[model samples]
Target chain A: MTADALPPRTVRSAPDRLLAVLAAFDHAHPALCLTDISRRAGLTLTTTHRLVGALTEWGALERDADGLYHVGLRLWEIAALAPRGLALRQVALPYLEDLYEATHENVQLAVRDGGEVVYVEWLSGRSAVGVHIRVGARWPLHATGVGLALLAHSGQPFQEAYCAGPLTAFTPYTIADPARLRRELAEVRRSGVAVSSRQITEDTLSVAAPVHGRDGGVTAAVSIVVPHATAQAAVLVPAVRLAARGISRALGWRPEAR
Target chain B: MTADALPPRTVRSAPDRLLAVLAAFDHAHPALCLTDISRRAGLTLTTTHRLVGALTEWGALERDADGLYHVGLRLWEIAALAPRGLALRQVALPYLEDLYEATHENVQLAVRDGGEVVYVEWLSGRSAVGVHIRVGARWPLHATGVGLALLAHSGQPFQEAYCAGPLTAFTPYTIADPARLRRELAEVRRSGVAVSSRQITEDTLSVAAPVHGRDGGVTAAVSIVVPHATAQAAVLVPAVRLAARGISRALGWRPEAR
Candidate 1:
C-alpha cells in the first residue's frame, strides 16, 4: 500500500506505529533525539518514549552517552544476513578487489532497488580517481554504469516503466530520452557490458558488467570508474566483465547452466 | 530486565510479539517459512501470519520464490547507519586496504560487544592464510588477537569480570586460566599490541592493536592473520599497530588529546 493508504495518525495500528519508529531513520538522518524521533514517527511523546524504550531494550537501537539514538550492533548483525546485501557483498569482494588491483580505479558493486541503484560495495586505491558515491549511495538508472547494467537486465516491464520519463539527468552526457535509453539497454545486452561516459559527473567515466546468480538471472552489476580524460573503455571492459563473471561463479553460477 | 522478569508469553505486548517475529531469524536460521516462523517465534499461527504480513509489507523481510523469509534490503539500509558497524568500517576501510597491501594477509576490523568481539570487516588476498572468521563472526574476549586487544582496553571492571574464569578454549593456546589471562592483558596494555598464536586454530596466528576514538576510548581493533609456522610477530606488529593508529586518526583521534 502507498503512504496515502495508511490510516490517520490517531487510528494507526500498533504494528504501524512500531514500524514507523524504525522508518523514521534514513541515510540523511542517522541519529536522532527523542523529540526528533517522536515528531518523525508521527507518534505522541509518551508512545514514542515507550516504543523507543522497547526498541533500545531489544538492542534494535542504541542510546549513546550523549543521549542520542543510533542504529545498534544487534540490528546490524541481523541485517548482515540479507542475501542481497552483505551476503552478496561477501561473495563479490574478492572479485571486486581483483578489479581494483587490475585498474587501480574505483570499483563498485550495486543492485537495483526499484528505479534506483544502491551501491553495496566499493573498493578504491589510495590514488584512485575521485568518485563521490559512498557504499549506500543511490543513483538513478540512467546516470551510472552500474545502474545501466542493472536496468538493462531488469526485463521489459521494469525497463519500460523506468524509461517512461522523468529520467533525472546528472550531467550533459546522461541519457534522458526514452528511445535513446532503450537503445543503450539493447547495446548493453548485446555487448555484455555498459560504458557510461561522464554521465554522473563531468570528469568521471564508468564501465560496468552484469553479475548473474545461480539461477542464471542478473542480480547485480560491477563497475570501475576512472577520469574521463584518461578513460580507456576498451582496455577496462574485459577486466570488469571478468570480475563480474568471477563473482557470478563464486555465487554458484555455471557457464553450462546458461 | 532479565528474561525471567518478562511477563508470560500469553500476555506479551504487541510490539514485543512483532519483534519476536524478527528475533526468530538469526545467523543459523536466516531463512524460514511461515510455519517455521510461527514455531520459532513462539506465537500462534494467526499472530505469526499477521506480524509477518506487516513486516513483509514494510519491506523488513523479503519472501522468496521458495516461500522462505529473509532479511530485506530496507532493514539492511537502516542497519548500515550503525556506528559500531558499517559506519566505523567505512572510515577504517582505506587504512585496512593499506594494511592488506603491505602484508597481503587476511586483515580484519572488529569491535567489542559485551564480552565478545564482532568482526565488522575482513580483507583477504588470494594466497592469504586461511582464517575461518566471516564479517559478522563472534569470538570470546580471551580467544582471538582482536578480542584480546579489545578486552585489554575495555577498562578495569570489564576486564576483572571477564578474567573471573569460565573462559572457553578453542585450541590449546587459548587463554583459559585467569592469572595467565591477567598477565597477558597487562603485557598487551604495555606493548600497545596483542599477539594471539594459534589461539583460534592450530594453523593460524594473529597480531592486533587497539583503535582509539576521539574520546581516547578503544572503540575497535585491527588485526592480521598469518600462518603460525612462519609468523614473524615482530614484523606484523608494527604494521598492525600503524593501521590501527591510522584508523584511529581517521576517527578523529589526536595524539595530543590523550
Candidate 2:
C-alpha cells in the first residue's frame, strides 16, 4: 500500500459516500463549496452533488444563500438528545460553573470519543488562563487532564495499547515515553485524580477527575485549567474532585445512598 | 396523507431509512431496543439492524451494555458546533443568566423551525411558572411569547400564512383566531417585544424579545417566564429587550455601526 500504487478514488458504499460528505466538514472547514467537498471527500463531482443534495434535502446539511453548505439545524436538534453529549453537559454544567466561580479557571467537561477526548462543555472567566480548546474540539488521550482521567478508566487493554501509540509532544513536559505515560495513568487511578501539569502548554496545568454515570462507570471527566505560575495544584485537586462527584451524583451515580 | 390508508414504508430509500433510524429516537423515546427501532422507524428488522450497526460503528448511535440504543456522543459533538444550536446558546447564556438573575424566572431561548418554536435552551429557576418545556420541545408558533416574537419577524408572507393556520388553543388566552393573532403579531413587531399572558397556561406569562444574527436578521428569540399573578409584565419588557440586545451585540449585530 505505497503512495505510488494508490487508487485515484476508492469506491465507497452508499452509506460510506453519504458519510464522507459529512466527514468533509470539520472545525477547520465548517463551510465548504461543492468543489472543496468533492476534493476533500475524494469523490467525483456528480457523486458529491447528489450526496450533498440528498443531505441538504434531509436537513442533515444546510445550503446557505451564498451557496455554501453547513450542517443544518434539524440534525443539531436530533443530536441534542444524545445522552453522552448535551444531556451529560446539561447535568454537569452547574457543578462546572461552581468550580469556575470558585477558582476563576478554565472549566471543561469532556467524554471519550474513539481514542480522543471531545470537550462537551468549557467555561472560562475573564481572567482565566487561556486555552484554545472549544466545545467540539478534540485532543489526544494522554495530553489533557480530562483526557488522562478518561483514559485511566478506559479499561486495561485500552491503556496498554494507547500507551504504545505514537505520542506527539507540543512541549518537553508532554508525556512521550510509554513507560512514564503508563505510570502516570496508574497514579491517576490510584489517587482518583489526574494532574496533567504543563502538558498541553508550558505555562498551563490542569487538575481533573472522573464523572460516573448511573452504573458507577466513568462516563466523562471534568477538569480545571490554571496558570502554572500561580496554581496551587494540590489544593485544586479536591475542588475538581468535589465538582466531579457532585455531577456524578446528579447523573444518578450513588454508592452511599444505594 | 389520510387516516384510512397507512403510509408507504418499504418505498423509502436507503438515505431515508438511515435518517429514519436516527429520527426514531426523539425526546420521548430517547432510548430504544433493536425491536423498538424497527417498529418505530417502520423498517424491517434486518434493515434496521444493518443501518443501526453502521450508525453505531460511525458513532452516531451507541448501544449500551443492556443492548438498548441511545443517541451517541459523535452526533452531539458535531451538533455542538452548529451556529444556531448550542453555539448560539453558549453566547446567549450569560445574557440569559443576567436576565434570569435580574428576575428569578424560567429563562428560555427558542428558534423557529418550520412553523413551530423549538426551545434550544432553558434554565429552570426557583420561581414556579407551570409550563414545563424541555430543551428540545416544540410548541405552536402563536401560543408562546418567544414563538410570537420569532414568527412576527420571520417575513410578511410567512406571518400572513401562519396566521391562516388551524391554531390549537391551550387556554382562552391562546390566539386561536386568525385575525386577532395577526393583530397580536403586528403589536409584537411594533413594540419590539412580545408579551404573552397566560397563552399556554392559566397562571403563567412570558415576555420575550427577538435575537438577531451578525447580518441583523432575526434568527431566534429569548424569553423569561414568571407567575402571572405576581408578574409586572410591563416592567419585564425592558429587561427582556436589554438581554436580547446584549445577545445580539455579542453575536456581532451592530445596528448603529451598520
Best prediction by lDDT: 1
lDDT (10s digit) by residue, model 1, range A1-258:
234232338987788899998888878889999987888887888998999999999988999999999998988988898898999999898888878877779999999989999998988776889898977788998999999999999988988988998888888889999999999999999999999999999999999999999999999999999999989899999999999999999988998855
User: B1-258 in candidate 1: lDDT tens per residue?
Assistant: 333223337988888898888888888889999877878777887988999988998888999999999999888888898999999998899889889888889999999999999999999877798788988889898999999999999879989999997999899888899999999999999999999998899999999999999988999999999999999999999999999999999999998855
Candidate 1 retains true contacts at a fraction of 0.72
- TM-score against native, each model: 0.95, 0.90
For candidate 2 chain A, which ten residues in a row score worst on lDDT?
A1-10
lDDT of 1 at A189: 96
Candidate 2: fraction of native contacts reproduced: 0.45
Candidate 1, which segments miss by more than 4 Å at Cα?
A1-8, B1-8
Task: Please provide the root mean square deviation of candidate 1 (C-alpha atoms, Å).
Answer: 3.2
DockQ scores of all models, one per candidate: 0.70, 0.51
Model 2 TM-score (B-chain only): 0.93
Regions more than 4 Å wrong, model 2: A1-10, A101-104, A125-127, B1-8, B100-104, B125-131
